[model samples]
Target: MTDFQTAARAATVAMRDVFPATPLLRNAHLSDRFDADIWLKREDLSPVRSYKLRGAFNAMRKRPEVPLYVCASAGNHAQGVAFMCRHFGVNGVIFMPVTTPQQKIQKTRMFGGDAVEIRLTGDYFDDTLRAAQTYCAETKGYFLSPFDDEDVIEGQASVAVEIEEQLGRLPDHIIIPVGGGGLSAGAISYFGNGTQYSFVEPLGGACLRAALKAGRPVKLDKVNTFADGAAVGQIGARTFARLRDVGLANALTIPEDRLCTTMLDMLNVEGIVLEPAGALAVDALKDLGQSIRGRTVVCVTSGGNFDFERLPEVKERAQRFSGVKKYFILRLPQRPGALKDFLGLLGPEDDIARFEYLKKSARNFGSVLIGIETTDAANFATFFAKLDTNGFTYQDITDDEVLAQFLI
Candidate 1:
């Protein structure tokens, strides 16, 4: 066995001391839908509800001589490290971006208890990482990198180890979620050339794809924080070094909105509550299409740290992506029977979700903001056709992010 495989196997065995291996369950719903023997590696079921715990435990255990551990994360990694710190009875100072969800922050505290002190700084993970490293330097604490450390990579490879053991055979394909690249790098190291791998990243923060295209890791100009767990401006250099040989062929980027639909589907249909990042692998299954049919495929659902507060946002995005919900701004004539005429355009399935009218006294027309949700996506086409046929003037603002921030 290669050195990495050897270390990863050892990590897998050591992880039993902390928590049992997360389940590798046959997802009948996905299997039937895709015509494949689909399995979900339930990393979301881990003690921290993320595969990050494996890496954090392995990395911290190796440095027992050190009295303290430090790290930065958006959420999952922080929880992982905090859980490990409590497990090992070691002092941990976790640095997290201020934007991290309250659910995660509270959980990390609950896990670490009094053993860990959390400092919230930075607007992104990279900035949080820098602050952590600086604190580590001054305090002489062992800084646990979320993904960049070699030991963490080996630890994360335990996921691959459990998969092979649980399945009793190699899967034809493994679809993995990519954020900082630690888990993907570790899996690649453990599996070698025996299996096909698909790396799925949030479209707004596809650092792995960007790195493959540039032949080096580069910071993205901007990152959408919707998929908070998997959204990072840059991929880890150490993780990228391991992932370099894979190229971009197997990498898939799922749009943030499109991914929301998958999240809602998994929740409503399968009763699986997957966070935005955790659903990355499942969302890629749609794009895999014919390639995975009749074959055994594994999707690593990375984390289930979804806060209930985000449910409305998730539903909104899912509706928009499905084309069944729309927002529009229209110029309605300020005349008798005008409002009634506009109401006549609605089909039986159409429901008005929002209607706000702003009147301009100097003008003959009033600006009206409307949100419509219909039973079928095709209903929008018919609705638009009627609007065009009539004299009503409107602008579709569902996709207009600028106006959405201000009006919708």
Candidate 2:
């Protein structure tokens, strides 16, 4: 076996003391629907509710002589490091952006207990990173990168090791969700050319796709934080080194809204709670289609540290993407029967979620902002057709990002 494979196996062995290998369970629902053998490497079931602890634990164990460890993260990485620090009985200082959610901050503290110090600094992640690095340097502490370090990459390879061992053989294809590229890079390096791979990234934060396109890591101009687990602006340099040659054809970028549908499906259909990043791999199954039929496929469901408070937003996005919900600005004649006439256009399946007038009183016409929900995407066609036949003037603002932000 290669040195990387050897080291990864060793890390996998070491991980037993902290947490058992996460489940590699066949997802019957997905398998039946896709007409393939679909297994989920359930990293979402890990102790820290993510595969991040593998990397953090492995990296920390290698530097046993170091007195202190420092890391900056606004999410799973922080929790992983804190959990490791407690397990190893080592002093750790974790830096988080001040804007990080209270639930995440509390979880990190709960994991580390007295073994770690939580420092909240800076309004943004980049700023928090600077603060953490500066503190590490000043204190002569070893800084553990979330994914960029060599040790961490090898640690992440434990996931691949566990997959092969649990499955009793290599699967035909592995779909990996790409953030800073550690898990995908480690898996790719561990398997080499033995297995096929599909690298998935959120469309708003597709650092891996962008880097592969540019031939180097480039900072994205914008990153949507909806999928905070995979919302990386740039792929890590060390992680990208291993992933740079993976090619654009093998990479897929999932639209953020479309990804929400997968999350909701898993929750409602499978009783699985997946954060946006965790759903990326399963979401790719829709695009893979014929390529994976009748083949053995494994998708790494990366994390489940989801806040229930985001359910409404997730449901909203999922409905919008699935074409079951929409918003419209309608020009209504400022007459008593105008609303009743417009309401008459809604089909049996259509429900008015929202209806309000922009102006309480208008001379001839009133601007009505309306939100509608239906059972079928095709139902919208019928509803809109009815609006047309009635001479109702309306603009669909559901897809108008700026307008939706302002008006909806």
Candidate 3:
């Protein structure tokens, strides 16, 4: 075993004093869907509902003399550090973005109790991270990075150690979610050449993939924060150093909207709760297709910190991705029977989910915003063809992100 792997195994053993190993359970639904023996490393069931606690615990445990610990995270990392603060009975300050979810903020507080102080700083994480670092430097407190530190990587590697012990042997493939690369790096160090690995990232925040392309860590010009847990704008330098050798072929990026569809499917069909980042590994299975068929694959379900309030948006995105929902701008003639004639063309499966009349741009033509839902994708094709044959002028706005953002 490599020296890193040795440290990872030791971290796994040390973690037994904190929490039991997360389960690696075979998932029948995924196995049936992919024609593979699919298993889920249920990191979502960890103490802080994330694998982050492992890194937090390991990093803190190694430095008992560092009485004051500081960190910057508005989501899982903050909660992880807070939980560790309470666990180690140490003084810590957690910096969080002001726009962080109330649920996360409350949970961090609950976990830390009086052991940690919560600092709500800038609206963006980058701004908050800088603030935390400056404060730590000035106060002589140790800054605990979310992924860049060696100790954290050692801690995250515990995931791989547990998998090897529980599964008896390495699986053919392991799918892991990538944010800053700590978990992926740790796993790679632990498993080495024993297992094939696939790194899953949100398309909007594919920092690791971008870094691989650049041959070094590079910041993204813009980041979509929909998958906030995994939406890191830049790959951490130290973490990327460990992951720089990862082949671009092993990285997969899933669209944020498409990830929402997977989240909904897992929820409704499998009764599984997955946040956007948590669903990354499972969602990438579709892209792998036949390559992994009949093989044993383990997908790490990284976190389940999804707020129930986002369910409506999740359902909307899922329906949209499935083609069961659509939005269009219909050019309606300003004449009698026009509305009735349009309604008569509807198929049996089609239902008007939304209808609105915008102010007319012309005296003879009135613009109408319409949203339709159908039982099948084929139904929309037939509906569109019928509209074409009848000389209906309409623009499909379902895919117009900019316009949809403003109007939908």
For each candidate, what is the lDDT? 0.93, 0.94, 0.93
- Cα lDDT of model 3 by residue, 1-408, tens digit: 688888888889999998999999999999998999999999999988899999999999999999999999989999999999999999999999999889999999999999999999998989999999999999999999999989999999999999989899999999999999889988988898888889999999999999999998999999998898899999899888878887999999999889998898889898889889999999999999999998999999999999999998888888898889999999999999999999989999999999998866678989999999999988999999989999999999998999899889
Q: Which ten residues in a row have the lowest lDDT in candidate 1?
A: 356-365
Relative to the unseen true structure, what is the C-alpha lDDT of residue 164 in candidate 2, on a scale of 0 to 100? 98
Candidates in order, TM-scores: namely 0.98, 0.98, 0.97
For candidate 2, the lDDT comes to 0.94
Off by over 4 Å in 3: 360-362
Q: State which candidate, 1 or 2, has the greater lDDT.
A: 2
Q: How high is the lDDT of residue 408 in model 3?
A: 92
Across residues 1-408, which tens digit of lDDT does each residue of candidate 2 receive? Answer: 998999999999988987899999999999999999999999999999999999998988888898899999999999999999999999999999999999999999999999999999999899999999999999999999989999999999999999999999999999999999999989998999988999999999999999998999999999998899999999999999999999999999999999999999999999999999999999999999999999999999999999999999999999999999999999999878988888887888899999988987789998989999999999999998989999999999999999998887
Question: Which has the greatest lDDT?
Answer: 2
For candidate 1, write residues 26-68 as lDDT tens digits.
9999999999999999999998899999999899888889899
